[model samples]
Target: MKKSLLIIALAISIISCNKETQTTEAAAFKTAYIDTSKLMEEYTEAKDVAAKYKSKSDEAARKLEVQEANFKSDANYFQKNAQANGQAWAQQKGAELQQRQQQLQYAAQTMAQQLQEGHAVEMDTLVKSVKKFIKDYGKEKGYDYVYGTGDAASVLYAKDSYDITDEVVKLLNDKYTTSAKKEETTETKKEEKK
Candidate 1:
């Protein structure tokens, strides 16, 4: 009976050890990270969005430049004719020019404000979309954790194998290409109908 009791105790210990190992193995996490700056630079949608905004900003700059040139021209004309126009007329014209300058400055400020707001909105939307995509990807890939590392790094260290930045960027680009193609096809169809 003493021998049997010792054997049973040993058996229980062995089984408990096996269960502990299994639990530890099951708890091991599958983790990955993406470089966010790389994603922003390489992702097709992000690049396209940035380019669109840049073009808009450039156009706005051009408009402002034209307004500035006109203002400068008017100022030059005022300076050349101010003496001939005499003090009273020169003062009245100067006031008008000053008002015009203020209006131009206001217009430029408003445009800059609008552009800044628009860029912020676009950035917010892009970030939200990227986050949703990453979440979905983590679920599909059975990743326990998917971190982002960039200038502001959320992940400090990850093996190259666990760095999925390229894969994520490629996947995002492919999706963007497919969507763009679909839009192009739709547009072509609409034009043909017209």
Candidate 2:
């Protein structure tokens, strides 16, 4: 009876110890968070993409300005000559001006739509790229969870030690620079071959 009781006690202690170790392991699971706003601001690829779109937007704006000037010129000409041209001629010129105005409006709308769509697509790609990099970084570093905190930070507070924003930004920028270099090299090689 005594031997059986001792064995049961020993088994119980071992089971308890195992459970305690499991809890400790669970507590040790690594987690970190990144400042997403900082990441976006510092990420080279994101800046490059923004600059690219800004140039496109600027070009569109210039085209619209030119169109606007032309439309204004046409309107001024019609205003000056409408009285001398007679009702029939003035009506035809007014109709032509109206059509040109509509065409300019349509062109402006189309450019705006294209710019919006391009921005959406570029932003989407940038978001995906950032997410993928973070995911891979977390996995590589054995992180159980890598949280993101930004303007609308879900994480109220976190230890500075847990913030990996700088590391992530550096990694992303280095990758961008390396890829850009490779592209330039390829272009040079192609030019040499030509």
Q: What is the C-alpha RMSD, rounded to one decimal, of candidate 1?
A: 3.9
Residue 20 of candidate 2: its Cα lDDT? 100
TM-score of each: 0.86, 0.87
lDDT of 1 by residue, 105-132 (tens): 9998998898888988988998899899
Candidate 1, residue 96: the lDDT equals 92
Counting clashing residue pairs in each candidate, in order, gives 0, 0
Q: Which candidate achieves the best lDDT against the true structure? A: 2
Instruction: Spell out the clash pairs found in candidate 1.
Output: none
Which 10 consecutive positions of candidate 1 have the poorest summed lDDT?
A: 44-53
In candidate 1, how many Å is residue 181 off? 0.7
RMSD of each: 3.9, 3.8
**Residue lDDT tens for model 2, 28-122:** 99999999999999999999988998999999999899989989998999999999999999999999999999999999899989989998899
